[model samples]
Target: MRADRLVSLVLLLRRHGRMTADRLARELEVSTSTVLRDIEALSTAGVPVYAERGRHGGYALLPGFRTELTGLNHDETLALLSAGPGRGERAFGLGPALASALRKVVDALPDAHLATASDASRRLLVEPETDLLSRWPVTEDVPATTMAEVRSAVLTGRRLRLLYAATGETARWRTVDPVGVVTVRDRAYLLALRSGADRTYRMSRVLAAESLPDPAERPDEVDLDRLWRDRCARFLADGHLTVLVRVDPTRRDDLLNTAVAVRTEQPGPDGWPRLELTYQDAWHAEWALWQLGPHAEALSPPSLRTALHTRATTLANRYG
Candidate 1:
């Protein structure tokens, strides 16, 4: 609490240049005696803080005093401010005291930047229901500080201690060599190689992590893009096999625009546009048929056509 008060006093003085003792006491919600004591403590800690007497004086940082983040450019400054208190606290490993300190830095920005940042904050709202977040299981909140550190290690190719919770297993710690971090939709993942292996783990499933000492023998250079592509291909291969569909002429535009890949479009016997869509599997094809309703139908693959008919029968039975 004392440390927090001291940090707040410093920030206030830095932002306002000077303030009366009474005003400081009021802002900090402490007695004037507490403010005076804090001022002494900050001075003792090498902060160039001083008091002045008379109508114009309270407390001030000595001229030329600057904080650690004084060199950030305008855009960087806005980004820091936009990240808000939650991210700032986590990114810098600061608790409440550090949050108070960052507020001063944000407050000290030029008026124009401050206004712009404020306006942006009001206009930009990040809705929480993104696809990745929706799909991810609720486990525990990942601290911002940990995520930032993990990201740093990933970029630097450093080994890290990861506390991972595998599906159907208790969380256990492991030392991993982090390769990178990836974001799919709203979910965050740490792509890391296990200490002795070539595979990488997702960060979301990771419970906790710590950086490790650099290895003596470096692993072979990894082509991250190639690895990602291969992983995706494998995942798709495991899904349902391909199926084709035909779209009605009235819905041809929607099919052409919405389908993953529309292979062909031509008039069928009834003057409807037959859209050939190569689906990843039967389930997907059936789902598409349901979405299209009577506007499209499965054209080939007798098995899928039969499945669709069966699904329609089931639906009719339920209603009947």
Candidate 2:
């Protein structure tokens, strides 16, 4: 961690030239003492750095001393400079590191293209910090300590004792073999084996966690994407309740996109589209179709129709 901070410090100086210890500390989110120690470390490591004493003096590196890093082609340089203020980096606690890396990308560019590239990048916008019309973004919360412990367990191939709070169930501890951690749509999940069965646990629902001593018996090599796909396929296949439905022609894509699957499609007598679909259960079918409202109608399996009608009546009565 100190090494990483040291590298970031060097990159900062390389990018922005001489900066006060106070400024560096603020940029790196550390104390002035830490920045001083890092500067001493860099000097000890043979970095050509020096201190200046004056009313407007601070730390500076030897002119032209740059960290030899990845050389970006023209397009890559533009892409790096045009990237969003990454909210995803906050999810993994890499926000500062990402910023440092982006700085390095700019610092590493050839001088001939530097000004023009930097100027052109300013023309592009990707989710600016504030806009007059846009709402502020809210990311999901997972306690930092809990996420760090979970991250350590998954990275080290260790088992975890999870105090997970399942829906409507009392908080209970389970020992799970860590397979991987995934952040989907800003929500983090742990894909693991609990009692030799695949399970997915939302990181937010984990009340507490502790790493186990024993190494998890995870495969030496894993393709996490493939494993996730297999898990998803099995989950969908297990959702056995099938229904026949008719949807307005214009909303066919909307229905298909929102619904889990459309197993079959045809045209009905009125020339609207008809579809056969599957769902996890009756509640799943009822709720999913109910959200579509009048655009789609559950045609058959009589039970689904009755369930929808009952729900509509209940809503009407409540509103009345």
Q: Tell me the TM-score of each prediction against the true structure.
A: 0.46, 0.60
Local distance difference test, each candidate: 0.67, 0.82
Tens digits of lDDT, candidate 2, 1-320: 67667778888888888899999999999999999989998898899889989998999999977676455566667777776354556565456677888877777777888888788788887755655536454457888788889989999999899999998999999999999888765678889997778998989899999998899977778899998888767767884678899998877765765566677888899988889987878988888788789989998889999999999999999999
Q: Candidate 2: list runs displaced more than 4 Å.
A: 1-69, 82-84, 90-93, 111-139, 239-280, 299-302, 309-320
Per-residue accuracy of model 1 over 109-183 as CA lDDT, tens digit each: 777777776776665444333334254333334676677678667667677777888878999988777765555
On a 0 to 100 scale, what is the lDDT of residue 247 in model 1? 72
Model 1, residue 268: C-alpha shift (Å): 13
